[model samples]
Target: MPIFGGSSDSEDERTIHHTPKLFTRQQSIHSLFGGGKFADILLWREPKIASTLVIGVSLLWFLMEVVEYNFITLVCHASMTSMLLFFIWSTASDFLNWERPIIPEVVLDESSFKHLARSFHARFNQILSKLLDIACGRDPPLFFLTTISLYILSIIGTCFNFVNLLFIGFVSLLTLPVMYELYEDDVDTVAGKLMRKMRKLYRKVDSNVLSKIPRGTVKSKKHT
Candidate 1:
């Protein structure tokens, strides 16, 4: 009769050993956001809040641009337009499921918050890595160059146009809300609860330490 077995005992051992390597290789790529680190916390905890903020600010900025078109200089208009475009593109991408973050909804207790913070740090590092990769890519050299050029152009443009300067100033102000949202999305998740707790603890400790320090120790030198 023909041998039913595909391989000898040694062959089976070798096959088993090689199979794991294949799995390991596959896991390497799939493990980029392993262990619930990239879960969609923002969606769970404050979807409405985030959605409203993004939509509201975006609409307001667009309206301001429209209403004050004549008041803004060309350079400032360009800068504001660029910022608005970026915001629209980013929001649309999130909506389209192309580059949406996986925010998890975890309770924000002290221990959990710390873990979330670590995960956020890891996620942020990954994002930075991807950004650097794109910046250095051969096909995108112009994108990086244009960013630098735009800043310089914006400065020169602002110098000649008060409206442009005002638009740029408004863009700078908008950054605070964007950053706050990002922080909330990253830290207000289940895995990041430990970090929030640690922050509170740290603040409490700092307060106590400050309270212990004598007020008279802070000397204000008189400038003549």
Candidate 2:
């Protein structure tokens, strides 16, 4: 049996002796900061390995909060450092008589350019059509269509506020998945208990409140 992922004694020993914190911070840090070869190995071998990007991004944003650094300054610094490194690498390459190409050549002739343009145009139109379909409720009920309309309006409102946009990104991309990954068992346990309690409460509410409340007629669109 294989030592990496097999149901053998060697695999168990490897897990215990080599990397005890396989799902913890040490593993994540190694995966991120490890060189191109390390990353390539992970990609090639365990292509479908679970990523903790949400938690990673959340921690990054937290660090950003503590440091209180200017975004523009950080961007400028990164740009300058990248350019300087490129020049230094080129100089070293020449001095050491290294002949390997660092940057790959992109042969963007007229024909290729036209193809690229067409691809972009097609994608744009496809996305536009999809958005229109969602907005118009191509197959969904009017209630769901209204929900979609409100969601789009909410997004438009959020676009005006940078903080709101940042929070949305944090919740949607970073916090949600990471939180789910880290506390999945706990979350499920809590959810199960909560659902049981909710079922009881729902039954009570249905008997006591809902039965007494008069139902109102839902206004429907008249057929043209």
How well is each residue in 83-121 modelled by candidate 2, as lDDT tens digits? 888888788888898663468797768986676677668
CA-lDDT, candidates in order = 0.49, 0.51
Candidate 2 weakest ten by summed lDDT: 1-10
Error of 1 at 151 (Å): 2.7
Alpha-carbon error at 163 in model 2, in Å?
7.0
Q: Against the correct fold, how does model 1 do in TM-score?
A: 0.23
Q: Report how far residue 166 has shifted in candidate 2, in Å.
A: 5.4
Task: State the lDDT of candidate 1 residue by residue for 1-224, as single tens digits.
Answer: 10111223454445333332211133322243342523222322345655565566556555656555442564587789977877877788877866744456977689877887887898798666655654674223233444666799877885656544655565454444344445633423432333233334544755798467776667899999
Looking at model 2, residue 214 earns an lDDT score of 98
